[model samples]
Target: MSGILRFLLSGLAVLLTSYLLNGVHVRDYWYALLVAAVLSLANVIVRPVLIFFTIPITFITLGLFLLVINALIILLVDFLVPGFNVDGFWWALAFSLILAIFNSLFDDITGEKAKRNQD
Candidate 1:
């Protein structure tokens, strides 16, 4: 199903992103899968709270502060996940940006067919 495909693609993105960044390390494919799942959960649960609390700064920065929130989420995941590691805040920021790009690319690849079917 598309849900399973999306999950797998997300894991692939994580693995690929880790490979692309020197400061990011993922132990293996399985860990990448775990990282993807945790990252999704963090985005769902933690991200909203962060956005709510930092609304003023987020607004002041013209939405750039969301990148900081993304980095913080990566750092939090690095703390919670054993096999996935981000070297530091800078590394976390780089990892997050790269991951977002990968995720978007993968999503477009997978989503195009679904959109065609829907149309």
Candidate 2:
């Protein structure tokens, strides 16, 4: 159940990114859903390998290289999925930053602990 909800939220975040950014286009909600799933899978599978290979650069940049990795993942998804397009590297970078913001906001909104009383 949580997985389904998380997927839906991620899809919504992708749609939001499409709307908010000029160079990113999601053809429809279905495409957004597919993009979200692929992006998640890429993050899980490809990102770690990338991090391992780029550790020296990542360390040199004081962890900022992760943003580049995130943008690359977005570009990878764009390449793999039709109907979801990211125009260029700059656009992918902007889309990735915005998507991260939206995903964090979504997590806060849907988080179980968020509903718990502070008392």
Candidate 3:
């Protein structure tokens, strides 16, 4: 299924982000794949609750606090599994930036969603 391919691609993105931003000690491709799987699961299950809790601060910061959210996501991934290790908050922030860039490019190339109909 395309979903599986997308998942693999997302994993690749994570691996690439690790290399470019954080010093991910991934032993092999499988490690990255595992990290990707865990990251996705955490995002789906835990992120909403975190976002809800941070809403007031997020609003106060005029949405820049999303960077902290991203760092937390990275920390959560590191906590939930092995093979994905970011050194600190700065590395996590860099990881988040790379991940966002890679995913946006992937979605654009794959036509993953409809363009906004600005009318």
Ranked candidates (TM-score, high to low): 1, 2, 3
Ranking by lDDT: 1, 2, 3
- Report the alpha-carbon TM-score of model 2 versus the true structure: 0.92
Candidate 1: tens digits of C-alpha lDDT, residues 20-95? 9889999999999999999999999999999999999999999999999999999999999999999999999999
Q: lDDT by residue for model 3 over 19-113, one digit each (tens)? A: 77635555567888887788788788888888899999999999999889878888888877676677887888888788889988887887775
Candidate 3 yields a Cα-based lDDT of 0.80
Q: Residue-wise lDDT of candidate 2 within 1-119, one digit each (tens)?
A: 87799889889999998999889999999999999999989999999999999999999999999999999999999999998999999999999999888888887888833654553
TM-score of 1: 0.93
Q: What is the TM-score of each candidate against the true structure?
A: 0.93, 0.92, 0.88
Best by TM-score: 1
Q: Go through the candidates in order and give the C-alpha RMSD of each one to the true structure.
A: 2.1, 2.8, 2.6
Better of 2 and 3 by TM-score: 2
Backbone clash pairs for candidate 3 read none
Off by over 4 Å in 1: 112-119
